[model samples]
Structure formats: C-alpha cells, structure tokens
Target: MKALPSSSGSSGEKEASSSLVIALGSSLGATCPSEPPMKARRSLEPVLLAPWGSCLLALGAPASRPTRKSDSFLWPFGMTTALNRGCWHKSLAMMATAIKLAVRALVEVEVRRKSERLALSEAVAELGIRDVRAIGLAHRLVLETLKRLNLLDEVAKAALAGEGSLEDLGARARAFLRLFAYRAVVEGASRRELASFVLSAREALGKGTLRPIERALGRCTTLSLDDVLASRSGDERLALELCVPTWLLRLLCRDLGRQVAIGLLKASLVQAPSYVRVNTLRGEEGEILASLEQEGIVLEPVEGLRHVYKVVEAGKPIILTDAYKEGLVYPQDKASCLAVEVANPRPGQVVLDVCAAPGAKTTYMAQLMGNRGLIISIDFSRRRLGAWRKLVARMGVKVAFPILADARFQLPTRLRADVVLLDLPCTSTGAFAKTPSAKWRLGPRSPKNMAKVQARILRASAEHVKPGGVLIYTTCSLLVEENERVVEDFLRANPDFELERPEPFLGLPGLRGLSKAQRLYPHIHECDGYFIAKLRRES
Candidate 1:
C-alpha cells in the first residue's frame, strides 16, 4: 500500500498528514481485517453507523480487525460497532479535531470573562458536545491550560518577548496561544503534532486571527519552562514554576509559614485522591464492597472514618458502575466525610444544613440519622437546590427537605435545630488540586471579602442552633481569613458558643490558638485542604 503524503502546504494538507501519521503508528502493525481492503472499506461506510466513520474510511487506509474498544470511538455519537483500520484512524482525527475546537471555545470564553468565570461543567454542557471522550479530553485540556496559566503566560511572554504581551493579543489568539503553549511545554507534544495543532487552530480560528502569535508558537517549542522560572526571584519564581499567582503564594507563606505553604502549593498542583462513602441507608459496607469488587472496583477503607473508602482502582469511572446507579455509594472526599462525622447527627434530631447544595453533607447526615431526623438543607441558588433534591432522592434520603434561601440572611422560618452545619463558601485554596480554575479566579482581596461573608453566615446560621446544641463550621479552604478569623470573630461577638474538639478527630489543630478545631492540608492529609470546627452553644 502507498504511504499517505506528508508535505504540509495548507491547513487541510497538514491535517491529512497528521491523520496519516497517527493511522500508520496506531493501526499499521497491529491487525488487519480478513476481508480485502477495498471490500472492507465499502462495508465500513454504511455499517460503522457514525457520521465521521465514513469520512475516516474514505481517507484511504488498510483494513484491520475490529474490537469493542475501537467501536467506542463512535460511541459518543450513538454508534457502536467494530471499526476497520481506515475508520479507526479517521475516528482518531475527528475526535482530536473536536477536542481542539471545544478547548479553544471554552478557553476563549473564560479569557474574555476577565475576573468573572464559568464552571467547567457549565461550559461543557453549553457546548453540547455529544462525544463523551471528546468532552473528557477537552475538559482535561481546559483545566491543564488554566491550572498552568501563569507558567504558560510566562513562556509565551518569553517566546514572544519583543512581539507583545499575552494580554495585548485578541481573546481567540490568546486562548489558542495558551493552549498551544500548554501542549508544547507541559504535554511535550511532538513537533509534528504541534504544527498540526497550530494549523488546525488557524483554520478554525481564521488565518488572520492567529497571525499575531504564529511566530511565537514556533518559538514556544524551543523554550524551556525551567529556564523561564530560573530567571525570576523568590515567590515570583515559585509562583510561575507552580503556575499559581504570587499573591496566593504570599498568603499561604504568611499564614502557614514558608515551608508548609510551599509543600501545600506543590501538592495542590497534582490530582487529589478519589474517595466514596458507602450509603449505609441503602446497604451494609460489606455487601457494597463485595458488589463493587465484583465489578472490578477496588477500595480501601480510610483510617478513622466509618463507611468511607479511598478508591484504589476502578477499571472505569466509578460513577458508571451498577453500584453507583443503585446509590449504594456516594462519591465524596475523606476530608468532607470527616466534617459530617464531626457533626454526628443522631436519630430523631433536628439538623439544619446551611448553604447545602448538591447535598453531599446533607445526605451523609441523613444516613447517620438513620433517616429518622428532620433535616432542612438550605442554599442561595434554586438551581443548586434542585440538584440537592435529586441527590436526596437518589441516596434514599427521605428525611431531608430542600430550602432555597441564603444562610447569610434570616431563616425562612423560626426553626432552631439540635445541630447546625455551616459549610461556608470561601477562597477554596484547599481544593486547588480538584478545581484548579478557582486558584486563577481568586485575587488578593478574595479572602478578606469572603471572610466577611463567612462571618455573616456564621452569625445568622448560629441563630438556628438551639441553646446547648452543636454548630459545625467547615470550609474547603486553607486561608486563615476564611477559616480561623471568621470563627474567632463570631466567638467573640456571640459569647454563647464555645469551641469544642470535633470527635473522631483526624486532622491537625487549627491555627492561632484554635486548637480544638481540625485542619486538613492536601499534602499532609492526601485530601482536599479542609477546616472543621465544632462549637457548642451555651445558654
């Protein structure tokens, strides 16, 4: 068989060359269809049942034996069939193109938003991307770019030094350049792949749109991220190297000490461990574990926490398994589970969950209560509360009621509770590994501003706690302003609440004499940076 042409004179030519190389690499030496190549190609066009399958086979390649996994290439578009060699290569090309376009669109929109932002889930849904694999890949690329934004910008600035600042580029151009830089520097994509990516981007974004950084993209391939960082000094160098803002670094250093802060920052750059809590209301832990093991999902019980396990390995996404569909388990972090355990809602008790949405804590509380308690889950967003309702139903939680109201304001009704849970919103520095975009969205004033809100909510929610009842405060944030300071201010003003050690304590003591509270760091705990304080209201 003749090899595909390799000369790249236009965007289409480059794309063809790239696709041919991918086909030659992945499909050439593995297996070939038993049928003749021509006959197989003709059959695949109609039989493959995917919009891109025929286009892929039409590009011309040898036939190969089909497999179930290969068929999943068309799964996103409602096609499920074994693909011949030619269609497989074309599927790769089409999926790659789709991912590139999706990433470009998402990054452009985010960059244009300035300080305001859209959640990645919202962006993915808005794009209406039907391919699961494409959605996953595009989401990964978007996060990688955002997580390493500072480093990517530094590299772009160095490569395009005399050209112009990244801020000066058009939104589309900036997005493309950042994506290219991440692929080139971080992913180490081949020169050929990089060239193909750039050409495809030009075609999609318009030739004139990418004109400004065309030369810079070429220069980015030659630059080294380490060399860029070595040129800076102190926190600035650390910030650029870790792809975090200098202000955030300084904040961590000042609050947690330079050594501890550096460790936390470095840990935050990597992926956090996945954990799931077995739904005791649905089944026993032993039974659930046996069922999950039958499905090839391995989990190890987290030390000190009942019903929570760290995912050792699952052949696929844990959420897709039958056990998950049956609501035998809920995907949650160990640190988060620790907070609910500290709250320790008892059967027949009245519990108020403030700012509870998506109901991870609320459902867990219901489980601990044996579904025999009155639990009111409150949040400011009606949309999020709707999701909370679904979660409640899915988890077999019958004792929880969803309320749409801000916890920072007065309660909707005069309903004091035996236990009040306040998981307030803050800078979310502790969860950077899981939600990297939050790091970029935050500014120096964010912690201070968020502290005020936390304090207000803490005060208002405290009213819902009956005298002598427990009030648990939690945040997925490491900042002292949001964690200890707010609690301290509330304690000083209220005078009726006294800090108490959270039972089944697992994390280290809180900062600045708030030793009774528990604090979890990503590096230290192998979980999200979290803070939990249990206080009892005194009459």
Candidate 2:
C-alpha cells in the first residue's frame, strides 16, 4: 500500500489541520472522563481490518484541546485558553458547528474559487483549537467504513444531500445517526445499532424549523433506507450496489463480465490488505517480523510471496518504527511485488524503472540484485524522487539511482539494459477501495490518454533494452486499454518483441492474442487489481 501524496503544511499549518479531528470528538466534549476505559478493539485479522476500522472511527471523531498537564509543550496557547475558560458543552457545540462548516468546505468548496478560500482556512484553524488526532481518527473511520462496505458514495451522498431532495428526508436527524444508517444499509452495519444512531442524531439536531437542513437529512435517510432494504439478502448484485454515476458503472460492466464486474465493485468496498515487503537488504524476513512483534505488530504470511505479510495489528503509525525509518520494510501490495518478479532482475542485470517515484519496486529490484546491479529509476518530479531517495537510502539499496525526467521521453543517454520495468501511470481503476477520490475525479478519456502514454513509454524504453532483454509493462489498473489493448497494439507495431510468460507463478492469462500477459483482480486475488506482461526483444 503506497502512501498517497498530501499537501505540504507548516508547523502552524499542521496545528490548523486539526479542525476535522476536533469536530470528530464533539459528541463526547469535555465530559469525556479523564482516562475513559478504551473499548476493546475488534480483532485485527484479514489485512489489519480491525485497526483500519478503528482508524476510520478516529478520523470521524472531533479533536480535543490539549490539557495543561500534557507533554508536548507546542500545544497552542489559544487552545489551552479555550479549554480552561469555556464550558465543556459549549465547546462541544462550537466543535460541531466547526465540523459542519469544515465538511461543507471540503465537499463543496472549489480550489479555484476565492469565495471558498476563507472557509478552507477557517477549517484549518479549527484543527489548532483541539486535539487534531481525534479528527484524524474519525476521518480514517469514514474512509475505512466506506471502503470495507463499498458504501463511499452512499455515505457521501447522504452527507451532502440537500433539503427537499429524496435523500434529505432521511438524513435530517443528527449527523451520527445519518452516518450510521448509511453504514448499516450500505456497509452491513447492524439494524439495532443503526436505529439507535438515528434516534441520537434526531435528538441532537432536534425537530427544527430549518427546512433546508431537514430536507437534506430526509433525503439522506430515505436513500440510505432504500439501499439497506434492497441489499438485505446480500445477493452479489445487491451487495455490489454502488452509488456511482450510471454511465461509469455501465461502462465498467460492459468491459468486465457481470459477475467479475460486480466482484470488482464489491471488492472495492472491502478494506484493502495492509501488505508489507521486508527489506531484505537490511535483514531477513524472520528478523523483521520479530522486530515488528516486539512493537505489538502482528503479521499474517501471504501464501506465495514470502517477503510479503498482511498486517494484523498495526499499532499507531507503523512507519514511525525505527525499523521502518531504517528501511527494514515497506508497505507494498502483493500484486506490485509480482510486477518486479515478472521483470526478473538478476544480480548483474541493468534495469530501468520508468516513472519510479517513491521507489518501492526499484528498491525491491535492488534487493533482488543484492545491490550489485545498476537500476536507472526515472520520473519527472524531483520532489517525488526526494521521497524515493529517502526510501532507497533507508532500505540500504545502493544500485538504484533516481533520474528526474519524463517517462514518455527516451533516456537522454544512449544505453540499454537487461530488463526494463514500465509501471505506467493509468486511471488506477483497480485501486478504488484504497482511493475513492479517483472514482469521482477520473474521466472516461483517461484510458485512451493513458494508453497513448504507455505506448510512447514502451516504444522509447524498447530502444534502450539490450537484445534478448525483457521489457515488463505493468499498471495498477484493470482497464483493458491500459492493460491488454495497449499490449496488443504495441505487439502489432513492434514485431520483434514477443510477449513472454512470467516465471515462478504465472497468474491468470491475458486477453486476445496476449494470453502471456497476466491480469489480477482484487476480489479474487485479495490484492490490488493489476496487470503485467513480460516482453523479450529478439536477439
């Protein structure tokens, strides 16, 4: 699981970022007993599903102001003042109001609009007013809850529904109630709990004269009720019920078979497996696992890939561990690990990792080479490469070097390598569960545009590959144009390169005449939906 890129923030900005966290804890307010008994967390099985669930809940809770006695003296004086002077319930109301405003700003505010600028800053400022950690926890819950149940759109829609809309009638209750029902109907939340949540929300919001708010709540509730009732039986069709744009779902269903399409959609709702790749350069797998266990982290060994493990109990930020900081392990998907294997980098092999930023596979290849081979890793962004360098150094990888250059263009110097790994950029449809933002932001034109880009990269990289060397193409995408279709077109134009079978374990075969290429689906594989093809240049 690669970390998503986030916006840059300052020390002050980091403090301001707690607005959402503060909002998340507004329900309990100051009445939160000092040292309230922590509820027993759910079992951390199936790719750290329980920890991931807790993460989301934490994100949804409001942030809290720092207590005077707490460590970390950087806590804002204004926040301390708020805590010391205000009534706890008054703080709760303020937190709720701030969250509502922040959510609206997040969902509806446009980046280019000046009118939204103030709202965005206001939201950020709220974070500094309370413990931002609680907000982060709540946000995590919102994401995990939706992902695990394939209910992101349903929840988002309910959250944003307007007054007088069908969704509004049902959502008019308190915020938590509406959210609970959305989870219940769309994500398999229990009915009794959902009912209780609904009642609580109603009590919080009260039967007010705010018609727009009422309408919004009503529409949200009604839609959620319909979805829950419709999916009561857990039929694949019912379970895969998505609130996606009709055209998108139609296109996806057309490309993939009905059952497989539904499976892909449903799988996106399931929490992604928290897979970690041990840094063989630092220590063996046993040593890394032992270190992790010492910190209360548990791992489930994946069947085929010995280096990979499904994180069972991920405590706090696992990346913060000294082992991780020292580059002992990295979080990577099994499907991604397989891509490098398909490339088959050897000890003395010279390879090219195009668009290799944050260098997960590049380092993996370096480790496979025992740090003896040369790997030219190229990407256009220096900022991205900085992160790659950080990881490379941490992992003790010496052979791979980063090149800041466009992937579409040929390498500046004339050189060929034994293997060329092209993990081309695509629409990333296969990663919907982990990144719901892509679902809403990506357009239909993405596949065609990305196909052209992959073609250019393949053609350029082919010129550099030594005769008899392999050129492996891969994408974190399931779309045919970016996967099978791109390969088909490339093979037709470049007759000298033939698609070759991947070694060790050959996954499900490809489409059309490219059966040698492998395609993996998240639902079936319990990994990211991915595609890989190994092509060798004729000697």
TM-score for each predicted model, relative to the true structure:
0.81, 0.69
- Please give the clash total of every predicted structure, in order: 1, 51
Q: Which stretches of candidate 1 lie above 4 Å from their native place?
A: 1-84, 91-105, 108-119, 199-209
Best model number under lDDT: 1
lDDT of 1 at 224: 63
Cα deviation at 208, candidate 1, in Å, is 5.2
Q: Which ranges of candidate 2 are over 4 A from the true structure?
A: 1-136, 141-215, 218-223, 227-240
For candidate 2, write residues 1-539 as lDDT tens digits.
12221233111111112222322332222222222111222222111112323422332322344354332211110132233443433534443444344343333222322112223344546544443433433343334332323343344445344323323433322333334434333433332223223333333344352223433332333344344334444343353355344455666777776678778876775556667888889998788889988876788987776577877666644555666767787777889898887777889889888878768889999988989979999876555677678778878998987777776776775768999898777766787765544555446676787688878888888898889999998888787878888888888999999988886453677776677788889888888888899989999
Tens-digit lDDT track of model 1 for 1-539 = 00011222101101112222212211221121111111101111111122222322332322243554433232222323246434654555554555454455456446543211233344434555445444444544554567677888887887686878878887777877887777666655544345445444544566687778766765676666665676799878878776789988888899999898988877766556778899989998899999999998889999999899998776655666788778898778899899999999999999999878768899999999999979998877655566677778888999999887766678797998999998887777887765666787678898898888788888888888999899999998888998898889889888889999998899999999999999999999999999999999986
lDDT of 2 at 337: 91
CA displacement after TM-score superposition, residue 508 of candidate 1 (Å): 0.5
The number of clashing residue pairs in model 2 is 51
